[model samples]
Target: MKMMAMALRRITLSPWQTALTALTIPSTTTTTTTTRPHSTLMSPPVVSLDLPDVWPPNSSHFHFPPPINYSNGHRAAVIDGKLIAEEIRSRIGSEVRRMKESIGKVPGLSVVVVGQRRDSEIYVRNKIKACEQVGIMSTITQLPDDCTEEHVIDAVSSFNVDPSIHGILVQLPLPQHLDEGKILDAVSLEKDVDGFHPLNMGNLAMRGREPLFIPCTPKGCIELLIRSGVEIMGKKAVVIGRSNIVGLPTSLLLQRHHATVSVIHAFTKNPEHLTREADIVITAAGVPNLVRGNWLKPGAVVIDVGTNPVEDPSCEHGYHIVGDVYYEEAVRVVSAITPVPGGVGPMTVAMLLLNTLDSAKRAYEFS
Candidate 1:
């Protein structure tokens, strides 16, 4: 939990403190330094982007709880993951430099990407770029969409045995023909930086046990809550979706922090009813605009993990990224919410770096 230790240090910020500083500062304000133990994870001094412009029109069924007045007239404070990630990367760069100076070693990450899915490739590219920014050596093993399961497993296995590679990640959503579970299980537990190994999941699920590495996306979600000064202990949380990569682990992590968590999936009845009771909501269903305004409880803190792309012929890319929760409606109801592109997405990369660094620390016996 060393990486989590950094996040735990900042969970003490009070609601009033968050209200006062959350989104009050303008986007142009200079970033400020802090003495907090995990200050690097804190929301930056200024809002990275204005919410009203990025978010859509909103309405909420529950209004008993007064909204925190962000300076920009948005009811909810934006959890700017981009700025937070920059801080984390800056800190990691410093640590990597320190490690190299002290032990003549740096972390290395190997990614095994299968298939030509545009989203998967883009994500892998971002991961490689992030690794470079933090001084981690990264290598990518790309395979064709038609590659056999054994080919993907061999790719992961090679990295596992490579002493220089401290972390190994298998880019998700493998080809339909491949057995994903078998391939993931093939990764050595020690180098499973993506934390997909069954052992890691088991450790995460059990009490009095901790995984060698936590899954990055779930770890990032908690970091967002911590960095945003949202208290998790004793709060009601609802997680939509139950994928191993994000949802199930997120719900487990929330429970670790003493939150009462409910999970909603495709089979669930009255998903909105379960969601509205949560103080914190994390949606990763991958269905765009699945969680509407009425699904949220007033004053709830939301982390939108969904990154579905919607085609928009007008946009340059012809597609725009969006979260599972409807930004427009949820913004008005929730006291705090993370935007799709600028929220949990960046934190995921940051946490991956942290995990790789941690694995290197273990391998090198660096404090």
Candidate 2:
């Protein structure tokens, strides 16, 4: 029982724990908070502040640079996710430097990769690169494709107790021979930067509870929407796909922002019909061109999370990536849209850095 109490206290110190609390509790000035009864989906507590009603109520903290070099030829404003991601990374880098200077400590991330899948290798490589750019120390434990589940668990356990390591990530899609759930459960809750732990997901689903870390991809989707100045509260949002990684958590996040959300999956009939009525659409169906122009409501904001590889001999690589929504058609219809390659991809990595930095701050009790 003593061990469990200690663990619970550690989880409560996550930086995200205060994101809603800051707004929910009124201040001395003209700010007032009005919270309704919690719904089944656990909508966030709504607060009315004296400041402007923007996507991110606390934009002053980020000091985001003005959007630049965006494509304007289309009817819809192209959301430059890559540029926003760069800006976020810059802020994270600065914060990392400050932490090191004040406390003589930097964030550290550990990744355990089991297989030799080409896509997984690229993902791991990009994560390591992002850590390097943000001044975070990263270590990798590469196991053979046929390694036993115990081997993977042992590696993760080693990092969990390491004071120097603030984040522990186990690369997904483990070998068929391994038990994925057991391996994931082996990661300590305090260091589960991937946010796949059951406890973290449970907190995310509850009304007043906050997760230590939001899953990187889902968190990235929300960041893209907020930076683009899309108003989420009281809007009709539709999520395509219901996978644990990007789809399910994303819908939950949208609800947290007070958006009325609908989810479309393989079993859902006439998915496009439901999508066409949404003010905002986030599709991660992984089926390229699944969402066409006709599927969207005019003036709707679209975030394409799908990155399906299609053969393109004309391109430098053997294949090129396409999104669930057909861009050429979407650009002309929606008021705003994120392109496939430059959209959610970079934001995912940036969010990981943010989570790692937050973890380290909690570990060292840094402000």
For candidate 1, write residues 100-177 as lDDT tens digits: 999899999999888777578668888999999889999999898899988888888888889999999989978779
Per-candidate local distance difference test: 0.84, 0.84
lDDT of 1 at 271: 73
Decoy 2 TM-score against native: 0.78
| lDDT accuracy of residue 153 in candidate 1 | 82
In model 2, how large is the Cα lDDT of residue 334?
Answer: 89
Tell me the number of clashing residue pairs for each predicted model: 0, 0
Off by over 4 Å in 1: 1-74
Which 10 consecutive residues of model 1 have the lowest summed lDDT? Answer: 50-59
Candidate 2 residue lDDT tens string, 296-317: 8888999998888888888776
